[model samples]
Target chain A: MLRAAGDWTTASIGDAERAIANVVRQARGVKQLNIAGLGQLDTNGAMLLLETAELAGEGQAVALTGVRDEHRRLLEVIAAASVRHTDAPDDGNPVLRVLAEVGETALKLAREGVELLSFSGAATMAIVGLALRPWRIRWRGLVTQLQATGLNALPIVGLLNFLIGVVLAYQSANQLSKFGAELLTVDSVGVGVLRELGVLITAIIVAGRSGSAFTAQIGSMRVNQEIDAMQTIGLDPIEVLCAPRIMALMITLPLLVFFADVMAILGGAVASMFALDITLTQFAKQLQAAVSINHFWVGIVKAPVMAVMIATIGCFHGLKVSSNAASVGQRTTQSVVQSVFFVIAVDAIFSIFFLIIDV
Target chain B: MTSDIPASTHPLAIHVRGLRTQFGSHVVHDDLELAVRRGEVLGIVGGSGTGKSVLLRTIIGLNRPAAGEIEVLGHLTGTGGAAAAKAIRRRWGVLFQDGALFSSLTVAENVEAPLREHSNLSPRLRREVAELKVALVGLPPDANDKYPAELSGGMRKRAGIARALALDPDILFLDEPTAGLDPIGASNFDLLIADLQKSLGLTVVMITHDLDSLYAICDRVAVLIDKKTRIDTIPELMKINHPWIQEYFGGPRGRAAIASAERAGAAV
Candidate 1:
């Protein structure tokens, strides 16, 4: 026999549940459920009791005693509504399921790739059209975005690359000193910082900071239906929103890369002085002899291309955001990941091209 | 321990006296006095930005009154420590204006949240109880697995109510329950509240601008004006000489709502 006592309201639900569990577990072979001692039962408690009785298995003839009329109504309501069904199970083979999922993702990627190409074409047309009619460009918005994306990112990029330069010089000093060629640490630091690490780190930082900002701003606007409001008033969102940001990034990134290159080299020089006991004069002379002007130009020339990739991917994901709050966060994360990956991949291609042409 | 006291001895489910609420230099309410009796549905009405929703929030301990004594279910709100506040909170359930179900969890999981947090029921029993609450609010069984974003506006409202009723609290607070529903859906919601109130003997406090809901189910109407509340039965409220109340109750929408309620009564 099952007996429940005390208040069965929400306040006492924990104790009530424990009691019900104890009774149900011990009532496997028992038939009659007694509740004459039950006190202060409400709908939640009644539902729990009714559920326990239903779980007593088929043809067990479970009988509930001492139930008042009010509790009985609630039990009937719960019983009438307790029809349970499970969600449909997937019937396909596991191998086929994996293949189907891979195919679906590839198709989605292909579709998005085409969309990105079309957006690039449209953006190029807008840039050309604006060049022909320079009076129509929003110079104020362009300046503001330039300041936000470029000027604000200076300190962080400088500090990070400075630390990278220090670590590189320190490690090179350790290895080169074994060969009694500690002065060669300046050559390694200059070439590495000038040709690759400087521009690569700057691009990655911009993609994370400004690119994610672009996606989050536009994605939130899309979620709030402000994009539709803009279109209603005959404003092309791409021209008004995307163009200024892209122009800002294209103008500011090369300058930031130049700044990053200077900072990284200076950091390498400072580290060389401390680790290899090389004077600043000697470090400068070695950098001038070992790293050619071609190395710096190669890194700077890749800046505009990386800028285009980050800006376009950021704006593309922003415009692609669905009208849900969750989609804004998802699109922002995707923008950062995609832009960083593309920037690195394009940098590798540039490296190969420069190698082939013997730059 | 307080559950053993019969509900009737405490006629006032909610009591607020000398209440004052302010935000910066703006005062939303001052010297406000109101009381909600046991087992009654009280509809709070006012013009936009008149602090009807603020009053509900203050009573439920979501907002603190600047100066006042507010008691719900005989427990003081806002002055209570964490344990006392939690005890009071478990005695009532609140439904926000937009359903406010966690967007990530499915409908069934949303209903199961309070039960999981406050009880030790086995997984199977919790699932059963969640489904029962889902059905009690008149949602389809298939809606159990759907997200809040996937449901229609009316369905989301029902799911919100189901979550509110998950624990069978004595007091149910609803904010703009029928604001976005159509006339038919609004009346159906009113009927649902009336049915649940009768069956469960609930004390309901609703903030609503829907005249039909106020006319359909409210035992009394509280009008917020002049930075305070005026509580009375609907007929008595209509007899007051306040301009806002007159405009609200004598407005075209108000007239239509009253006519519809009369028609529904005559048919019944």
Candidate 2:
């Protein structure tokens, strides 16, 4: 006869397993096991007892007596589960899995492209409708978004452009001085800063800062079902949520680009004064003579386009977020990455067009 | 009434005395004394803002009481050092409202978290035990690899239970386990808890407003009213004449739950 006693939970399984092993070894000739004295039993404990019974002998079926109904059911569950060996299927063929993943990603990207187009169309219609009914515009929401996406982004954008301008002027001075044409450094700085680096860097920074913020904010609202509540209350989410943000970005991004151009030129002037021994007045005069307003216009022209792309991508990914906390983080990252990528791609296309048409 | 201990050889799973919890002068529980015996299902019920969930959190050391003594499974819960508190925490598991699963992990990995934290089991065996727990909770085998977001509300709840039972805890604390479940699903969950409790000899402390669960599986019901607790069996509680208890136990939903339990041949 064998009696299982005391608690048999996982917390005490180490001692319980040892005790059960000793009991099973001694119970080789025993035919009955009594669980009547078993104070507490869990799945692990029950599994141990079942194994002991099996180890008692092959053909000698040990009868478990004094078994409570609940314990009996538990033992039965463990017994059934043990017999059915259901292992998760292995990932077959590493090459095939990689190919499959690539294919799936491509399909996902194609679907996203279509969705983005439709979203852009809807946003355009909303802007036109709001233009027709000027009073329908949410001025308060527009001002709030302006402060968040525009004013709050000023310091980082200004500082980053300033650093870029200083680096460019220093690097160009080295090569220009070799030919005794150090004054040509002003042309390089003016053209590079105003026509390319200033606006491009500003756009990338805004994409990372404001784009991810949009996704996180709207994704959280979607998670909490606030978006659904808005629709149910007969408010067009596009007009109320997307339009204000888009309009604010469109209006503020151009202004930000103009400010970035000024800061970068100021940085270049300071660098020229320090590195090339050029006076500040001479640097300013050369910069004003070398940089055409056409170059500044070219950079400012890309601002609204980059702004629209970033805002649309951010809000689109946000709306695509499923009702999971994890999805918000994932979508926010996607928003920033996609917005920056598209901004650079569009800027490249614009550069080619400008060169072809001799802007 | 304040210090009466049960005259049993086995210590109570939870013993509370002179519990006072307050938030900015909003008293939640005052002089709240309660005891939960070993191997019993205790259901805590109260209206909204009555501090039922707060009491559960307080006991689990997530929220500190303003003044009280809380002893859980013979360990002073909140008064201990970090290692001591961790040891006590390992002896119990808590299931939060809304399942509160780690959204990043699959169901199987979620169940394996405590095992990995506390035991030296190899990865294979830990995974095997996790699969066994998932099976025990009646989840489909395929759910092992699925994220919490991919599962329905009831399935998520079951996954949460599987994770809570990962370390084979002696005490299981659940917060509104069946709040978003349908009637059949709720009753099934109740049945599962009852079955698990009986098999494991678990001490379950659940905060719920589900009358069906109270009628079906709870061995004792603790009602919080007027900032204190009143603990009694279902029948004993039904006889109490307090206005809140009267309306609660004798209400239409309560009566319907009782009738269903009777039909199912449960001794109410």
Candidate 3:
């Protein structure tokens, strides 16, 4: 028995070509060239082995020794159309063969599932840790969120609220003036700004800005493999990277909400000053009187909760994204839309509960 | 070019028996046995899927062997005592294929990690030691403060070498150390290795396909074929009559080494 010994490598294209050349030149003198010990041979390597045998003039078979199942399979594939390495002795064991095939399939499924779970779990843990930490002074993750979602977010949030306020004031003013009921415009504007429109418009604006931004940043980091790299270096990707950002947004979002309310009110106040023939001060007083501190504080409280929720969700999805660059863009968009939807849904629930409690 | 323990006159460093490593149902390293002596360079050459990396990982205790006895440097590995396994690792240096330097840490910190983790050296002394090792690898002392990303590929590899030598390990493992380096860089690195081994009396185990390296650095080599490593000294390996050898040494690299040895014989 030939005691199999030594290393192996897959022959390269050049190696295969050379083998073919060697066989062509010496085919007449050889019986079978015993093939063994080449690992990771490519298609070119297979082709060369095949060509070598085919060109081996006549009456020659390349006897393959130490043929690993993979090698034998590859040889069979290459030799399907060409003649080479013809003699592969099979020590048949169906059970072993079935085990190998089934085991590979199971391993693949398990590996993929574990990787998916790893992504989701790691991302969720990072975001939850960030959101739950008390990094803001006002417990005002809400207030800061108002800022990011609403304050530094002002120009965009303000711009959007301005359009909404303008549209509301214009349409309502035109309809009321038709009946010479112009004075009732103050009542319409005051109640509308207080009960729902102001907070609703502002919250939507905040969601689009802060929520989406969070996702993009985290998603890109995921794409770059920085998270995995962090794990390898014994650094907590959440503590070192995500928490501070989440904390910053918490600080930013409530202030964002406060700014959004201002812009939205300004939009309504401007229309009141003009359309209702009420002075800015009178409009302000009327607006303030109509919506109690309860209404304002209620909306205000939702800012931080909303911020935490949006930031958490954004970071979670971003971190959960796949390694590919395309995943970042896709997840970022999803994060923005999902955050906006969740924020509105949560806000509505809170509003209904608070109103019910007050009533 | 330099003497590291008077050529290959070192004691045995690694011993293994009945080693087997499997991935799922596929057995990669089966009933493998090999021993490597200290104070000599042992080269490992293998075909793909022959479990070369698997064998190395098992011997180093990074991956557990399905069935085997591994005694590295007089210590049985894979026992429940993590401290002992870690101490064994602390006494050995490994340079992975891509250097595997911490990207976040400066070169100095990466080198200092093992020292900080295992040694009792003060911070100042550790920094000094790191600088010295960096300089020994022919890197500038300033290279220590630069992140792994700042350095070129060759520089990173050198930095990895510097870090590996930080603990003054008795055994050094280099996996594809010259895989991506230019010929000049690779040759210089080889010379650096020779000098370091000679001066430190280090036992080096290098895995490579570079035939020139086999002739240049290896005192012995093992062919990982047939699911186990069959090691032979360079002189004995040169005369090996096997199918793998027919394709390997019979190829350019093996041929070149033989021709060079003949030339040296003529010169002698």
Candidate 4:
């Protein structure tokens, strides 16, 4: 027999748990719980008492003696409400868990690949349909997206490429001067900036900025049931929302890349004037001789493809959002990651193609 | 052993005096005063934009009043030191409308959060307590492992109630507990609240617009009027001769609720 005294309520349970545990340990296999001395009893306290009885009685319900009229019902209720203990889900082996995680991740990636393919197909169909009937297109939304994704992105893209060009010119001029070829810095800066760095950097920046924005905007709309409302109203969300954003990005990205190329070469000229004591005319002459127009076109050609990849990735993840704010946050993060990853991968592919074809 | 701990000498669970709440140039409450008795369900009702939630938020120290003396469980809310405030806070639980369960946690983990934060109970014990709380709130056993997003509207509110009751608090504050529930679900929730209050001997302060809930479970109703409050029993409040009060209880919906409650009372 064990004496259950003192307040069993939440107000005192924090202090009483240790004492109760001690008693339960000492009273192992005890079959009777005496509660005549019990103070105020609430749900927490009753739960504690019931747990104590079960523990003391070796996982069996124990009888209560001296149960007062007031406390009897509470004790009975709590006992009936005791949660049936179930084994926690088997996390058993660390090595197996890690293997499972790897498999899950690979599966998720494959599923994402398939999803992206289907999304691209649908978007292409929408674009082709719109192209066939230009009057059916939403010109206002396309123009707005153009202004947002393109015009608004100009300053940052231009400034970043310009800075990259300055750094490239300074660093290359220093390296080339070691070989008594300081004039060749213009070639490295022009070819490298135009063919790779300028477009690559612009794509990355746009992926982080506009790509993430697309995901968050559309994902939140999905969460708010705005997408469902549009569908119910006989409007296709893909045609109405995704198509405009994609077209705008496709139109803007090349312009942005071209603008970036010009700004970077101009920056290289400025840097050459400072670093190599060469005038703008001399630098421009060297650039004209060093880089073919094909290098600029090579970079420009990658922009539209990268834009489609980024915008489609963004819109795909956005449309995948389930009905919650947390999913919106998660899908937005995924959109950014996938877009940036694809952008770099496509850039690598373009580089390889150019290499094979001897551009 | 627990009897030696210091108890609040005051009879009231909450006491507010001269509470002045405002947002910039707009005044919400002016010198509003309220006192909630121990072990009673007090319902706060008001018209739209009448600052009912603001008042509840102020009493719980979420909103800082422009000027007031707000005491909850004998501790001055904002004026008290952190330790004192936290102590008082632990003694009460507030359930916001829309369940507001942490989307990240499963239902059981959501209930265990307060226990984890405030108590030194063992992990097994905490889980047991959480499970019991969930069961007590009438949630299904499977709901313990399910995330809040998976639960339906009514189930989400029940999960919220389970979290609120996890601490076995002396006072429970519910903000529109039955707002979005269907009529049957709302009344069932009211009955569940009334049952919990009776069993736990809790002091409940509820903010609601549901006249049926007010009629069904409220011990007394506090009507927010003219930027202040008029506190009285429902029948007494009905006799106040004020226009808003008259229109409120005498309104068609209110009359229907009263009639339904009368029928329920007669059946009982």
> Candidate 3: which stretches are off by over 4 Å?
A1-359, B1-12, B15-19, B57-71, B74-78, B81-89, B113-123, B238-241, B261-268
Q: Which structure among the candidates has the greatest lDDT?
A: 4
Once fitted onto the true fold, the runs of candidate 4 whose alpha carbons sit more than 4 angstroms away are: A1-16, A29-42, A59-73, A91-108, A266-282, B1-268
The models' CA-based lDDT, in order, is 0.84, 0.86, 0.70, 0.87
How close to the true structure is residue A186 of candidate 2, measured as C-alpha lDDT? 91
Give the per-residue lDDT of model 1 (tens digit) for A1-359. 66556666766786667767776776675566777677777777777776677665345767887877757777778778766757788667999999999999999999999999999988888877878888868786798899998999999999998988999899999999999999889888888887899999999999999999999888877775446433322246788778889999999999999999888888988999998889999999888888799899989999999999999999989999987999989999999999999999999999999999999
**Native interface contacts kept by each candidate, as a fraction:** 0.00, 0.00, 0.00, 0.00
TM-score of every prediction relative to native: 0.58, 0.54, 0.57, 0.54
| Candidate 4 residue-wise lDDT, A1-359, digit = tens | 88888788899999878977987888898889999998899998888888888889997778989999999898888878889889988888999999999999999989989988999999999999999989868787799889989999999999999999999999999899999999999999999998999899999999998999889888877775456434322246798789999999999999999999999988998999998999999988888998999999999999999999999999999999987899988988999998999999999999999999999
Chain B only, TM-score of each candidate: 0.96, 0.94, 0.91, 0.97
Model 3 chain B is weakest, by summed lDDT over 10 consecutive residues, at: B1-10
Task: TM-score for candidate 4, please give it.
Answer: 0.54
Best candidate according to TM-score: 1
Candidate 2 lDDT, A44-109, residue by residue in tens: 888877777777754588888898876888888988877634698999999999999999999999
The clash tally of candidate 2 reads 0
